[model samples]
Every structure is written in C-alpha cells, then in structure tokens.
Target: MPPTLKKSDFHYDLPPELIAQAPLPERSASRLLVVPPAPAAFDDRGVRDLPALLQPGDLLVFNDTRVIPARLFGRKATGGRVEILIERLLGSHEAKAQLGVSKSPRPGTRVVLDAGGEFEVLGREGEFYLLRLLGEEPLEKLLLRAGRLPLPPYIQREAGADDAERYQTVYAKQVGAVAAPTAGLHFDEALLDALRARGVEFGHITLHVGAGTFQPVRAETVEEHRMHSEWLNVGAELVEQVRRTRARGGRVVAVGTTVVRALESAVRDGELQPFAGETRIFIFPGYRIRSIDALITNFHLPESTLLMLVSAFAGRERILAAYRHAVAQRYRFFSYGDAMLLFPGRES
Candidate 1:
C-alpha cells in the first residue's frame, strides 16, 4: 500500500464547463468509458453498448431507492431565508433536514415552506434540524405538494418540470432517497429489456442516499474522514443471486456506489448476508472489495467520497489517470454525466 493517504490524493483538475447541467435527449445515449482490471488502455463506448459488454450469466444489481422531492425554499418567523433539504423522514409526521439559513430557528419556531406548507422546528441535531409537520398529512405528502427535486449542488439551474421524470430511474420503487442512484439513470426500459433478453440477471438493494453525499470531505487525511450513515436493506434473495452467479462463473456488477456500499455492508463479517439497518461503510484504497466484480457508475466530483470509492475498486493512480483521460476527451462530468464500466483491479 502507499504511504498515509491524504484526501488531496483524490483531487483532480476539472473544467467547470464540463459539468453536465442537463440530461441528454435519451437516457441510454450517454457515453461509456470501459476500464479493464489490468492497468492498460481504456475503451470509449456508449451506455447502450452494455448488452455486449458482459457475458450472458453476469448478474447486474441496481439500487431501487426512489428520489423524493427534498428541496424547498422556506422562511423563519423573522423573514430570514431558509432553504430546506429533507435528509430523512423520522416518521410519518417528522423529518430531519439540512436547513440553509443565516440564523437557525430555535425549537418551537415555525417555518413556512415556499409552497405554504408549515413545519415546526423541533430542535437541532448536529448539521440537521429536526422538524414536525403542522398538518394531518404525512411528511412525504407535504414534500410532494411543496418541494422541488434536490438536484446536485453543481447543477446551476432551477428544477424544471422535465427534471421530475429525467432525474429518476424508471425502476425506482422504494421511495426514500434524496438523490437518484445516477448510474442507473443511464439504463432506460430499452436498455433493461435488451439486457434481460441477453440473459443478464437482475437484482436490487435499497440505500436512501442522504444529503451528506454532497458535503465536501473535511478531513486532511482519508483515514480521518467520517462517513455519513445511510439506511440500507440487502435481502437474502440478492445474496443467493450472487452465490449463483459465482457458481456459474459470472460476475456481479453493481449499478452505483450506493449499491456498492449496500452489498459491501451486507458482508461485514467477510460473508454475504441479509442486512437491514444504517451503514457508514467507507471504501478507500487498501480496502479489498469482495462484494462486486464490476461497477457501473457516473463520473464523480473531484475529492468526493464517490471518487474515493471508485479509486478503491480500481487502483487510485489508474482511476485518476482515467479521469484525466475523460477530461481530455471532454466527456460530461458528474451526476447527469457520462458513465464508466469498471472491472476491479488486482488488489480488489
């Protein structure tokens, strides 16, 4: 392994212009960068070419977590601007959210959400504020009526109506995630049907991505970083699918970093098992990944944990080199950007 790992080791130079602000006309029309396990030349392809990238028996696992409308503009009683992003629902009537306000309201203070939904601030919980809905409707219903889709911070634009459909995956079933499992965004019905016809097996896991996913890593060294906790559920069916894939000499391909964490968290004791709870698993170099053999993911923010996770799967230097190549090639970067099909490196 390399010497002490610094967060700076994951940093890369990206042109701001390369950040993708919008999705393409077709979901599967995005570009695909294929990186082999060996440290060699990379191949440029398209997302639609996934049908040909894997063998018939390979198992593809996707995160079925649905993206909720978590963002909204609100105001404190004193008229201070407050932007709310629901991190997680504590229950039917309560939620914990990240509030963007100059001065946070104290407990018992009421906030008027942009669309007139009212919520009472219960208290502060670290970086989040606990809130209670002031009406009979559940928190989810209130958000649907008043909130806008919380696009990533880099996407400089208001959430338009079109984003409601494009920002989510076609297979989103479990409703909880604040953010979409972007890697799955590239797989439309046509791509899914094609993969199924090609004999690719499918499975799912759920990991409700939290707002902390966008928070920048504050630690100077990678080891000092504390990963955010997210709820996950990995069932016995998927574990058995993985075992069957292994028996058939097929690979397990995780659709996104969320799925990677979900699968890895299921095997905390070095063996896959059913799991349902919060996970704070942090993947970095020197961490051997036995969960999935291949990964389908989008380009991630520089110095981001998602980038670090991908670097752990492939070698850090090779992944960074691939990032430089993607930059030179001018492939769109981040959430709504192009994707990569990666095979694990020797260490992984």
Candidate 2:
C-alpha cells in the first residue's frame, strides 16, 4: 500500500434524472464523447465514428466474458424471501454468493428457488455465502435455468427479456461475468465489421466482472479500499498481438476497464505474458499504466474505482472536467449509457 488518496476527492454531483434507466434501441447509436490527448479537450462524436478516429493498424482489445444470469429469488426453509447473487463459481455444483435475507441463513439452511431448484449454504467466505446446489445439474445450468439477469441496482427497474441480449456484448463467448463490460455494449456486428474493414485488429480477454462492481468505496482513503478480486484470463495470442501492434507503431486500444486491468495485470512483472487468475489491482493517481495506448469506455459513477482509473489514466482534474462537461451536456450516465473514446494522456 502507498499514501492514500481521499475518496472524497473523486466525488461529483450528478443529476439523478441523467441516470439511464434503459438502453437506447440501437447500441451503436449511443453518444460518443471523444476525449483528446489533452485531457481537458472533448470532441462530440458517435460510437460509429470510432473507425475514422483510429489508424488502420491499431489493435482494439475487447473483453469477451459473458454476463450470466446470476440473480435468483428464493425462499428459505422457514419461508423467508431471499435474494442470491452469484459472486464466483467454485465448482460445477457449488458457488460463492451474496445472500440477501431478513437474517443471514445459517450453514446447512436450504433455500428453495422460485424456479423450482434448491441450494444449501455450505459456509461463509468472509461476507459471501458458500453454497452447494441441491440438485444434480451443474451450477451454470441451474443458474441459466432459474436466474434473472442481475441489472445494476441504479437502473431502478427489474430485469426484463430485452436485457438478456442488450446487457451482453454481441461478441460475448466466455460465460461468467455478472455484469456487462458496458463499453463493449455499444459495438454491434455491423460496427465491428466496419472496424475490421478499416484494418483495425481485434483481440479478446475474459474477466468475470463480479456483483461487487456496484459496491461503494467504503474506505475514506482510496488506497485503503481494496478491490474485490475478479478472475481474468489474458491469453498468449493477445500478448503477441500487443507486441506486433506496437512494433508496427499501431496503438493498443482497450475496450473497457476490464481489458485494461487484464492487460496491465499480465505485465505486472515487467513483461507481457499470458495470465489466468484473479486480480485485485487498484489503479489511481500516481500509478503507472504500462499496457494501453488508448481506451474506449463508458462514463463511470462518481467516486467509483472506475472513475479513479480514468483519472489515473488522464489526470484527475482533466477527467473531472470532462465529467462536468458530460453532465452539462446531459449525456446519459452509467451502464447502458453513452460512451467515450480516450486518447493517451500526457499524464499516462
């Protein structure tokens, strides 16, 4: 740990009315704010403008982790209502989860799912519940059959049929994340094809975004707030792609924070390498970012780690100014909202 930054330093006032409750009918139609290398400067654009903004040889890294239906409503043996959000799968028949109940269920308590399956608490993993599926099916199968898409809480609406597709990336392949890599949500097959036709290269990484993404930073000092560990896999192919791109003087553009984290985590020991494990890497001011040349991302929550990350990438004052500008322009905010294409900052 290093000297801590005050969490309050990242705070900003956002109008609740700007919080996006639903996604636009078209993913690529979301407004794109192009953040130039000078952090304070902004260019109004659309996501569809991305191909024109990048060089032909640039490599775009995308997180391909799929969002699983991780939210389940159930009843305990005593008939009390319970909500379970899977945090991590431990085995085909077991998982770690956050259980919401009137009272935390004791180990051995059985919860009957509304979709007609059951699970029993095995024990606790800190604040999370370790549970075993009470049926023969694999945990993934049971969840897909019985669970609902766990939308971010700020959305203020129940998950609906549309979320099953809209909340996921069109290119999602690996199945595990509870939340979407929101920046990836703005790219459809057509947009991807357009980029490909322009000679932009693509690479994929997997990072199972946990439910803890929505957890507020509780520590007053930013460095004291530990990031929840999320499983990530940075493949060898992507490592090779990065080397090839930089060798050709092409930029390596990360699609979301997860891609940034995965790439950066792979190079923590000073050289890029394939990695498959958990990362609790927390990026903030004064941290050196070694992986990305540019980033395509969504507007993040005020006082969030994601915001801190962008601030670290582009200097705190400049990021906050862009945020204020976005607010003034009434840009939709948060997951399922608008996007931003950021160039390398002088501060990065």
Clashes of each: 0, 0
Candidate 1 per-residue lDDT over residues 136-231, each given as its tens digit: 888898888887899999999988999999999999999999999999999999999999999999999999999889989999999889999999
The residue pairs that clash in candidate 1, if any, are none
- Badly placed stretches (over 4 Å) of model 2 are 1-4
Model 1: CA > 4 A from native? none
* Model 1 weakest lDDT span, ten residues long: 339-348
For candidate 1, give the lDDT. Answer: 0.92
TM-score, per-candidate, Cα-based = 0.97, 0.97
lDDT of 2 by residue, 1-348 (tens): 545689989989999999999999999999999888672559888999998998899999999999999999989989999999999888798999999999988999999988888899999978799999976889999888888999999999999999999999999999899999999999999999999999999999999999888888999988789888999999989999999999999999999999988888889578889999999999888887879888999999989999998888877877887888899999999998999887666763
